[model samples]
Target: MSNLTRTQEKELKEAFDIFDRDHSGSISARELKAVFKNLEISASDQDIKNAMKQMDINNDGEISFSEFSRVMEAQFYRKYTHEEIRAAFDHFDKDKSGYISADELRMTLSKMGKTFRKDEVDKMIKSIDKDGDGRISINEFMDLLN
Candidate 1:
């Protein structure tokens, strides 16, 4: 029932193999922590624990190949429904306009305590505004999200 393509499934299997250092067909918490560290991915001990708990669906202390495949497939290939994307866009469009202005983006980010340089914001807007419009429409936002 996964949306992942054959290529994606193969890649996920390869990655899982790499993480399963012991070839035990499962990855332990210590192995997961080492993999994160080796990849320079910043994750706290608690974060790793939580991730294991979520991925280890069988309540096992380790993540089996099937579990890893399922989790990776969901994480990488799952797409949000149009209504969910629209609802999120509506939340940001404070003026009830169909587009999100750079000002609105700045305000939202500011509210979130995330400050970015003016150039950075402009770059972000330019990147997301696929139609070269000055603002991001719901369609554009959804495209960016996907």
Candidate 2:
């Protein structure tokens, strides 16, 4: 009953395989960023820096594929339930319009204690605004969640 299909799980494993460049079982900061870039996902420079700091459990500035996989799997598992996903979308739909608008995104992020400049939020919205819509549909929101 998990939301993750077998193909999706396999793809995740494949991604982990490709990102483990050195075969040392560890992905360096550069490696993780490379994967993100390849996926066409842009994080703010500070976001990447913060992620590296937190995800590199040993403070070594490097994350093992096992470590990365563990985090990803935990996140994936947590949202395996349909209700969990629906609840998350509900949280993102700030206006209660059943969709996520830029203001909604900004407000939700701000409520989470993230301080993003208006322009920065705009830039982020531009990047994730799939389908050229000004707002994110539930499907788009789910994609971003992943």
Best model per TM-score: 1
- Cα lDDT of candidate 1 equals 0.82
Deviation in Å, model 2, residue 23 alpha carbon: 34
Q: What are the per-residue Cα lDDT tens digits for candidate 1 across 17-72?
A: 77887789999998898777754457999999999998999997999988998888
lDDT of 2 by residue, 44-84 (tens): 77878887877777777787655666566666655445676
| TM values, all candidates | 0.51, 0.46
Q: lDDT for model 2, on a 0 to 1 scale?
A: 0.70
Candidate 1: residue 84 Cα off by (Å): 20
The lDDT for every candidate, in the order shown, is: 0.82, 0.70
Error of 1 at 65 (Å): 1.0
- 63 Cα displacement, candidate 1 (Å): 0.3
Rate residue 120 of model 1 by lDDT. Answer: 77
